[model samples]
Every structure is written in structure tokens, then in C-alpha cells.
Target: MRFRKFTSSFDTEDRLSITIDDIARPLSSIQSSFEGGKVPSEFVAPLTKFAERYGGGSFSSLFAEGKSARQKQKLVEEFGSVLYSMETEEVKNEETFLIWRDACRDIIDWGLKVDFMLDHLKQAARDFFGYMLRPSGSESSCREIIQMEEAISQLRKKLLHLEQKLGEAREDLHLRLGDDISSDSMSCILGSSWVPQSRASRGLY
Candidate 1:
């Protein structure tokens, strides 16, 4: 099933790039950077909350267990290594860069899905919390849940709308490339050849 999904993403040049160390080291470094002072202040509360509810302890408490910041960073770094190792093992025999690219696309797709889901969930939570502020615990409380359901429904609708727009854009790119542009594929076709390496020119992806 995963392989099927991977094949559908796109062809790429990362076929020989599937080493455990290659994937694990970068991911571990990224995770470790976050655990260190690299984390932004805006992320502190939410990250701390996520770590506590899902990661067993408060951020401070978790750090406390290791005796030092370096130790805490090491723990998350190790965790990242373990996760990447598991990911690599799962697809150790992948035969193509399409598989690698597909895996990356799947991850990106899942992230977008989770982002949309979390938007609605956060809105629902706000509504629920607002309702709780009221003294009444009657049938009115149920209305909050209904409001949350409606918000989630709207979120799904917007997501579908965006997906349709993206599909149309891809189709347009295909048609345009066939007409005038002479590029290898949609990615290279849509991405201007002269685009430089900078945050300003790199499109949302």
C-alpha cells in the first residue's frame, strides 16, 4: 500500500539516496536543534503542551530528568535517530527515487491534512472553552459541540476547494508545457529556470 502511494508521487534522482545514516543524521540534527535554544519563543507553549500530553512529561520536567540541557538535546536527538532508523528499515528495499520522492510527498500531504484538521480542532477547542465559561451546563453546552462540527465541516470544504484548485493548476501547467514551454516535467516547468536559492523566490513548498 505504501509503495503504491509512493509510485504515484513522481520520479526523482534520489534513488541511491536511501541510506539509514543519510536520513537519520539529518533528522536527528533537526530535532536536536529544536531541543536546544534554537526553538522559537512562539513554539514554546504549544511544543511544551505537545511534549507533555504526548511525550510523557512537561518540557522542563523532561529536561530535568537528564540533568542538563545537553543531555536533554541528546535524548531528542537519539529519539529522532530511532524514528528515522525505523522509517528507513520499513522501506529498505525501495528500488527508485520515485519511491523516495513519493515518500516525501506523502509526508507533505499528511502534514497538510493534519494542518487542516488541527485548524478546525483548535477552533472547536476555543468554542468549547468559551462555552464552558458560562454558568449553564444544560443543552446549551451541546451547541458548542455543534458549532465545532460546523467549523470542521467548513474546514473540510475549504480543503477540498484548495485541492481542486491545485489539481486545476497542475493540469494547466501540463497543457502550457505542451504548448510553448519545453521542460522535462511539471516541477521544472512551473519552477522558473532562473529561480535562485532564497526564501523570497521559493514558492510555498
Candidate 2:
């Protein structure tokens, strides 16, 4: 039996409406900045590494694992640190700095989009449970509800598995990026207050 019928009430259709174009624009802008010599020469190597690994050499590849918010957020933090460091240089080349700065902002924007998509999914899950709890009068409805319960249980298992994988990925990212780039520095560069907030605290993961 199709589970889509049961999930239809959760308004998830728009969640799936995120187009490749929406994801590609920022990535393409970053690439263009690199190619046009807008990014500083010192940053090119590390930025290239960051793009290939996190961006998968293309925006579409970044979302290949299904709009993972954790992955996107990690990318933002890593690259935002690099961008912030670049901006701290004493050189007064405003044009080049602006180009690079916009590219960094684009990365954050891309990450926020992923976060928004995940939020939609979480809300949809909540709505599904709420809808399922409503009283039903018919035998057919009851049977469908039973099927939905089973489906939701399986979904919970899958979500847990994904969460575990995400945790592993986070550890891997930390190992690859190293400890030299501090969160406090990134937060200062991004103009955001830094505090230790676990994944659970943020309602993400």
C-alpha cells in the first residue's frame, strides 16, 4: 500500500519543490568568483578543497544525499571561517573583498535553504502524528491508521539511522578540517553570538 496517501495531509509537496536551480546559484557564484580572480590567491587552494569535498564539484551533488541540513551547516561553518580570515587582511582592496564576501554569504544562504527544508520535514512529521491521533469512525479508516502506524514506525527507524550517519559525518568533518579553525572566530566573522549549543538544542540532527 502507498504511504503517500496517508502523508498527503501533511503538506509535504512544497518541501519537494526545491529545484536544482535554487541550489546551484550560490555554488555557481562561488565558482565564478574563483575563476574571475575575485577570491584571494592564498585562499584558492583551501577553498577548492572545501568546494570539491563539501560541494561535490557541483551544487546538485551537494544535495545528492537529500538536502542534509547537517552537511550544509558544516560547510557554512568551515568556509565562513576561511572567508572571515581573508577579510581580516590589512589590504584595502574593496572590490575583491566584496566579491569574496558575497560568495561566503551565498554559502550561508544555501545552508539556510537546507535548514528550511529540514524544518518542513520535521513539521510534516509532527502534523502526521497529530492527524493520526484524531478520532476515526470507520473500519477502513482504522485499518489505514494501523498501516500508517507501521509506516511511521519504519520511518522513525530510518530517521534514527540517518541521524547516526550524520553524527559520523560530523566527526569526519572535524577530523578533516582540523581544530585550527575555531567556532568563536567563525561566529565573530559571521557577526553571530557564539555559545555552545548541541545539535539537539538547536532541534536539528
Candidate 3:
């Protein structure tokens, strides 16, 4: 199918709608099935390593960057400024309005990154899950791969819930924030090949 542009009119991304279909294809659909335990050349190592090392010391916290000094400082400052404005007076002007709007966008940015990472992890697990299904693999290893797949399943559910909360919260930020925010999140959309179009794609997995 040809790609469509992202231009959602709803506060919540109506992911099934024509507007959101391209940018908000559910993460579960990001990787098409790998028939007969096959995967693309680029994915073999990452998919394999991810399936094995998950839930172990080798894996990193998903929130490390989100909670890092720089990100914390930035979010704190933005929150404080927006809160200060709200406490002092209503945000009526474009400046104060945009400040609040941007603060919300920043929050969305974090959510998007986390969602993207989780999607990547789950997709990696899926690819590896398929890889493990090769006839020569041990039964115990097959069980282990299934376990990882089940664990990763939670990520997609959480992201769906997150998108709902984010959409709801955007109401207070103003209904148009989705439109006002750059098509930046547009870049987060993925196709069946597993390429993430966003800058958030870098180092995601």
C-alpha cells in the first residue's frame, strides 16, 4: 500500500482512521511475519541477542535517558515555568499558550521514545522468537523464547493505554496540540520492514 500523510483531527490519534493509519500503525504490526524462521540480514544478531539478554544485567533500563540529568532538568524547567504561569494567571497569550503547549509536547516526546523503544524490543523479541523456531533448536530454548515473547506482549498493551492517556491529557493542553506539534511524531511511524523514521530511531534498541 502507498503511504499516507499524518494529519489527525482528533485529540486522540484515531489510529484506525485514514489520517492516523500511516503514522500510528500499531507497534504490533511493525514487523511482518518472518516465514520459516527467516529474518532480514540486518536483524539476525540484534534479534538474537535481544531475545537472550532480556530481563538480565546486560539489558539497560528503558528510562535511563528519560530520567537522566539533562532530560530531568529540561522537563523540570518546562514544568516549573508552565506551572508558574498557571499559578500566576491563565495562559491566554500565544507565548504562554505555546509554552504550555510545548511542555505537553515534551511530555509526548518522552512517551514516544519509550513507546518506540518498547516497540523495538518487542519486535526484536518477535524476530528472535521466529528464529528460535528453526527445527534444530532445543525444546528448552524454544520455551525460553516463548516466555520472552509473552513478556514483550505487555509493552504493546501499555503503549495503547499510554496513547489514550496522552490523548486525554492533550485536551487540557488544547485540542489542537496534535496538529500544532510538528509532524515530528509523524516520523515515528513504522512500516512492515521495521525501520523507524523518527530521529528517536537512533540507538533505540
Candidate 4:
């Protein structure tokens, strides 16, 4: 999400940082990037599809209602007035006001950009959640939902396998405790961290 602007611009030759990689990672090894430096042509199509359907508008205004740069400029005008007023009370603070106003303006721009990018990423995640529910029916069709389904199917198989392992946990009439995926008390329930109980000594068996 920090790298949402990567959606705004890229070429077949462009390299990516880890943040962009996380968002636009290849679906399978067939679409994977090369070691250290591979152009991101494979990801651009889906990202473009996402931007068109869900971005609301231009890359500059992706998740935001308006252009963040223009909004930042408006904020500068409003806050610069306050900085100027503060300067009037001090000893020839013209340079100081200029410095503080510029710094604050930069900070505001950064905050707005970061906020919009992160929001855009969160919205994309929500969209994909719906897409996973009904892959072919979703508007985001550029992405290969089959790949996602395969990954999820693999996970389901693993969970079923784990349930088989847990079936072996039935011993000495001890009721095996299972947990929801959230695993609220899982840490205390596992391994050396577990405190042994005295059920055998109590003659309950």
C-alpha cells in the first residue's frame, strides 16, 4: 500500500521494492519475477484493471475524492496564513515562517499521500475478499482467480490433514481440545509450554 503509486507508473523494465512486490506478487511461479531485478509487466495488467474499476479516478486521486496535491496546496494557503500571523508577533520571523510553512506543507503532503495509498490498498483487499467469494462473477477479472483458488484449496487440504493428526490425539479418554482458527489459548495449549495435569493420579481413568 505504501507503494500504491507503483500503479500510477511503471514500465516493462521497472524494478520494484518489497512493498510493491507484496501487493503485486505473481500468482504462480510461471508469473514470478526474476532474482533481485525483474520488470513488472506481468502485474501491470491486473493493477490497471483494479485501478480502472476500483480506483475511482486517476492514480493521483485513487482512493481519495479529489487530487491530494491540490488539497495539499489548499492546506498550505490556509496554514501559511496562520504561520504568517505567528511571525508578526516575533522578531523579524519572515525566514523562520517560510521554513516552518514549507516543512509543515511537506509533512501534510506526505501524510495525505500515505493515507490515500494505504486506504487504496485496504479497499483492494476488501474487493478481493468479495472476488474470492465469487471469482468469475466479480468485475476484477484480469486476475487469475484459479490461482487463488488453487492456493486456498491447498490450504484446505492441509487443514483436513491436520484434523487427521488430531484424531490420533484421542488417548486415555482425555477429551482433545480443538480451537477455532483464531486459536485464542493456543500458546498455552502447545508443547513444552504446556503444564501437565494430574488426571491419572486422580483415578479418573
Write the residue-wise lDDT of candidate 2 on 63-123 in tens digits: 4345465665455444534444443434332223233334444454655323333333345
The worst-scoring run of ten residues by lDDT in candidate 2 lies at 19-28
lDDT of 1 by residue, 118-138 (tens): 233334434444454557765
Candidate whose TM-score is highest: 1
Give the alpha-carbon lDDT of every model: 0.46, 0.48, 0.40, 0.40
User: What TM-scores do the predictions have?
Assistant: 0.24, 0.23, 0.21, 0.19
Who is ahead in TM-score, 1 or 3?
A: 1
Q: Which pairs of residues collide in model 1? A: none
lDDT score, candidate 2, position 75: 56
Among these predictions, the greatest lDDT belongs to 2
Alpha-carbon lDDT of model 1: 0.46
* Candidates ranked, most accurate by TM-score first: 1, 2, 3, 4
lDDT of 3 at 88: 45
Model 2, runs deviating above 4 Å: 1-137, 183-205
The predicted structure with the larger lDDT, 2 or 3, is 2
Position 199, candidate 4: lDDT: 50
Q: In candidate 3, what are the lDDT values of residues 78-167, reduced to their tens digit?
A: 333333333444322223322333444454465322234323423443444445445784768879988998888988889899999987
Error of 4 at 108 (Å): 3.6
